[model samples]
Target chain A: MITLSNLISRIPGGIAQGIIWGIMALGIYITFRVLKESDLTVDGSFATGGAAAVMMITSGISPWIAVICSFLIGILVGCVTGLIHTKMKIPAILSGILVQFGLYSVNLHIMGMVANVSCNPSKNNVFITMRSIPKAILVGIIFAAVLIAIMYWYFGTEQGCAIRATGNNERMAKAQGINVNNMKVIGFALGNGLVALAGALMAQYQGFSDVNMGRGAIVIGLAAIIIGEVLSEIIFPKGCQFFTRLIFVIIGGIVYYLIMIVVLWLRVDSNDLKLATAVIVMLSLAIPNLKKGE
Target chain B: MLRIENIKKTFNPRTINEKIALNGVDLVLNDGEFVTVIGSNGAGKSTLLNAIAGVWLVDEGKIFIDDVDVTKLPEDKRAKYIGRVFQDPMMGTAADMWIEENLALAHRRGLKRSLRQGISNSERETFKLLLKEFDLGLEDRLSTKVGLLSGGQRQALTLIMATLQRPKLLLLDEHTAALDPKTAAKVLDVTEKIVRKSQLTTFMVTHNMKDAIIHGDRLLMLNNGKIILDIKGEEKKKLTVESLLEKFEQASGEEFSNDAAILG
Candidate 1:
């Protein structure tokens, strides 16, 4: 049951899924690292994206347009969270949770009150699907590369630097005439937009979208980011370029998925994957603190 | 030029921890006037500066910078006309960003941020020339993170950032208070140089009496949410720590026995 070939065959699937999740991790990086806010809206926006994409694809819409729509929808969701946090004077974490909670009902509505929606590849002309794993991997890599390049260029812009400064130090940003609240709203919108894009890709790749597909997505994204940071430290002891950092985030996702494949191959209970993810995240987070202790 | 009229701010109104930070305070700063503010712990020196900076809305008052009322504007909006260097060097600049990037942000103050490159070659050259004036070897380390810089260097950089755009008004809130004596003097020296060079209207709050007297053209002493003494011109030049303490005691009707603490 635990044959090497069985595990080997799953590697491509693992890589494909990892790359999609890697895109999601990039979203998390914007909020968690750049904006310094742990936005929980991604968990729900992910499902919202999948559900929207599946429903559109099933109804004869172009899959590409469907994905783009999902991205825009995700941005609306993030704007709601941002407004709630800033204008309403609520805590950032609570605001994200509120949006995520509300998104469940909205996601269900998008899927026509159904828990799952599917677009059969045989009928629907989906752009990326599990039917051709190799093609999916190739497209995923291209998407990652293009996205990374855009991010590198965008973050080096004047408005982008303002967002970074807002995250780095709010008082300084404000004193420098940079609007801190507007920057935060923009950050949240951009972050969740990427998450929804990733969710749409995952939906198409698997040929189905489930309302619960985004459950525990934040932990996975965090896991990828932390793992990537560790790898970057090891490879470039001093520092690495921003582009390489982005690439390693995808590599980190790949490594995380490969490890999961091995765990599944070893006959670990499939239902225990969430527990495994928690362990991985907790260990990754604790390692730096433990090192500091020594 | 800056104007304040009957601005009053009270913290924790109706609560036991209530504090009357500023009470009906009014003052006008002329163009290129360098004013130093001094007080005890709760004399509302910072509260007054924050009011001018629009940190929070005053309960009752008006603030104007260059004849434009800014009492209703928030901190960021008012920042277009004002440059502030906080007591903590860390509060004035982003630590994770590079030295040049910090200067770039300061240079673009009051301007719209667009899709253009954050730091242009010409802007970088200007930043280098500015940093070189600090004589802290920061010009060569333009790419280095501000966090790695010493306290004095960071404070000096903050001063440069505050004056980069020649703001209508400059607010320095105990900016050099956290540095050592030599470093504090150095930063103050630089501050004097910049203010004089640009003729920028400036307000500096300091706990050290000597710095207050030595650096600015005018000095105001606050006590019990009021400006009890305003000394300037030849009289300010003739004042000393001992005489200033006497003035504080005469104005507030209280003994300032711990003059040494105030001198610091």
Candidate 2:
């Protein structure tokens, strides 16, 4: 118990979890921070990604191909979110919740089971594939670095600036020849695509895809964003430049689990994990607004 | 260079709040022409610019730029031809990004955005030279976040961003209305210098009658949703606030009631 090797092993798991959820954090960052769209579909779309990856891999697809499929599925899910917002004329937040509720069952069907999809049978249903925890951590880090680099480059372009413009001042962005509608659609697609890729990697690493995995993801991502925002405000308060937003979000994700690790170290039970997470996010969100008021 | 024919827009269409913003308005701007629009509140001055910018679909109209029927084009697709500055200084550039980065973005308008680490050395030098023209000491501070600049500096930077591409049509929708009068005048001066130096076709909307008359070769007055008066040539040169008001009543058959527009 609490040996150096055991701590190292758990470090890999915690970091892997942080990186996988970084995708969701990036998704929340786009909706809440960037485009200012509150997308609750994040939870549903994230599970859908895992289910899609599992379904594809189970159907004789290569592991890498399943990853691609997972990303595309995420894009489709995002498009549905947009369709609900635009064509159906539904409120954005409501549309997200509706889609999430639908995906709860759909994810079960994708796994060809009502509970979980596993690479091997176990009583507790924990599966261990060749994608070991250490390898998963490496994959997560490399994937995050590449994705953030691409994000940095993309947001530096005109279209990227246009997307940001939509959030800063929608009317002005439209008047300056930026289509806010199309930009929102693109932003959603990109945001969820990252989330799905994370899910694919997660399913492979854990050797199982379960429906409940995505639960409370949005809150975690929001907490990370709020924490990241607070950090960036204190560290680089002038602004979180294009690349810096993504960088800080990644750091936010890492710091989030480190806080979780500390909570677990304090012997907090599993039942209160969600409660602790909620409090942390609430505090992060509140402190900034309170400071502004003061 | 720009033509708007029979354009009409209704806000909250098919509802109780359906307010007609532009009622079959028509206007033409020759190449390299500088035109100013002045109107009362709800006069559709901004609506006309918005229609051309493709912010939304017009209920009825044809918009042409350099003889191209641009009404069917999307906003970003039309970015190649149009440059716009807005009343809010934040509208024109990404505030968190550096001044050079914003300029680099403006410079790459209508081009494919690639992953090749934006802003080559040559472009950086070019941006510096362009920034120098603003004389706002921005050339030395290209690394500064745009949000740190004063409103006037931001507006000035915004003007440069709009004109950097030598756009076929430049639209200014009360670009300086949000600033103090002194800063507004400074920004207006920067606007004038840029517009003239580039020799681009430009349409500027302003609430101040004096600014409208003093800045452009032509001034058009709007009331309700129609153009009440169009002055150009020798007649436009002779306009004063009083005489312009007299013409508004003559053309529109009503007294101008926009106190802010009149007093401004």
Candidate 3:
């Protein structure tokens, strides 16, 4: 029988995981919603960030510096995808796929040809750890809050407005003298950079990084975004500001994890978790269309 | 202030569907001139505007705006001097953006975009006043999305956007073609007021012969990628739909085949 103690013990861990995924969701929001471009590169870039962070920390680098480097490396990865899409004239989805495939090898190289790496929280000055779940949750929340503030400020700037316009209407953006191609590249770089930042934090929190850790990251990010949007519609019936919408995206991530905890608590087979995630995402996406029909 | 020299463009080159859109077309417009363009289907009117706007590089020849060679510039780079409204009302403004945001974007045309705030208090005031002048009650809806506006309102807003920064040349490619007759007429009225008030060098392509003659200081008829008739001044003012049809027949040695042009 599932007990109250079992549920209580899982809550902190769930909150930490949700906050980390919430950061990833914000990254996906930039590409999927703001740029209106499908980018699958996050799956590979997430692992790359984890590998970079773990390897750097193991090599005696500061954890904060290692995380920052992981973010920069992610931006470079995103730039490769952007160039493939914009300069090489490949479709956005195909370009992201190509980069994702290439980054699997690059990520392995970053981990010194290893598929996984682990850092001891005591040996390394790690940023966060599952040993202290409450501390990890607090750290994740702070990181998310800071990132959201930066993003809110960036999107209100002139350059950010240009990027928004490029996504909304390419023809109108070009007519307005906004370089649409450049905007796409900048967006990709920013999106992947944030995804990498989240990956770094996840690795530090879990005290391990693995190549397969980010296999279905894009789905999780989408789940967060869609859930956040749906919830925001209910919570703010009249309307809300852009910053509020972003905050909801983070909340969506938290809610996703809470649901996952509940499902696990129900004694569902752990091996079938991926299938459960897929069903949840599919339903979340279809609900809006289905509601419109009614 | 605008010149097109022997520009040529072909669609689906080397394929069975290959069609030459602009064939060695040449034209020039002095500063402050208002030129209306009329042509039948496949007459290269839209192609001419696209070439001048640098939608793509011309296969041959050069384009100049205000004596600056812009034939090699990409569309966004060429936007420094060119303002355009497309055949579709939806093509002009970002639908999801607020009305004031759209105006702010237009206000920054050809100017450098930085980390500065996208819209300032002063600029918002200016946009509010400009929307008030439209008399479409859009002034109160500055924060509303452009997608929620009516077709006529969108076109009028587009006209205002094209002239927000006083472009060196304005290219209107049947901007009101998609609107209903009444809405189209209202948009045309706004177009004329903006063009006349700014004396913007304009090239307007229209399917309506009456509109072609009723507005603008000069009118040109394009046929088979060539300018077959050019009328201006008192001659253009006195010209009617019948006389324009007669001129097309006289110049091209073919019947004026576009019923929309004649009936409109």
Candidate closest to the true structure, highest DockQ: 1
lDDT of 3 by residue, B96-196 (tens): 89999999999999888899999999999999898888787899899999999998899899889989999999999999889999999989988988898
What's candidate 3's DockQ score?
0.89
Query: Distance from true position, residue A155, model 1, in Å?
Result: 1.1
Tens-digit lDDT string for candidate 1 (B96-188): 999999999999898888999999999989888877876878889999999999999999999899889989999999998899999988998
For all predictions in the order shown, the interface RMSD in Å is: 0.5, 3.4, 0.6
Better of 2 and 3 by DockQ: 3
lDDT of 3 at A56: 93
The sequence of per-residue lDDT tens digits that candidate 1 reaches over residues A130-209 is 88999999999998998899889988999999999999999999999999999999899999999999999999999999
Give each prediction's root-mean-square deviation over alpha carbons.
1.3, 3.6, 1.3
Q: Considering the true interface contacts (CA pairs under 8 Å between chains A and B), give the fraction that model 3 also has.
A: 0.84
| Candidate 1 structure lDDT | 0.91
lDDT (10s digit) by residue, model 3, range A1-294: 798899988988998999999999899999999999989999999998899999999889999999899899889888998999999999999999999988889888888888989988888989788889988988988998899999999988899999999999999999999999999999999999999989999999889899878899999999999989889999999878999999998999999999999989989987898898999899988887898996
Q: Tell me the TM-score of each prediction against the true structure.
A: 0.98, 0.87, 0.98
Candidate 2 lDDT over A184-224, as tens digits, reads 88788887877777777667667778898788878988987
Two-chain DockQ for model 1 = 0.90
| Candidate 3 chain A weakest lDDT stretch, 10 residues | A119-128
The CA lDDT at A35 in model 1 is 96
Alpha-carbon error at A293 in model 2, in Å? Answer: 2.3
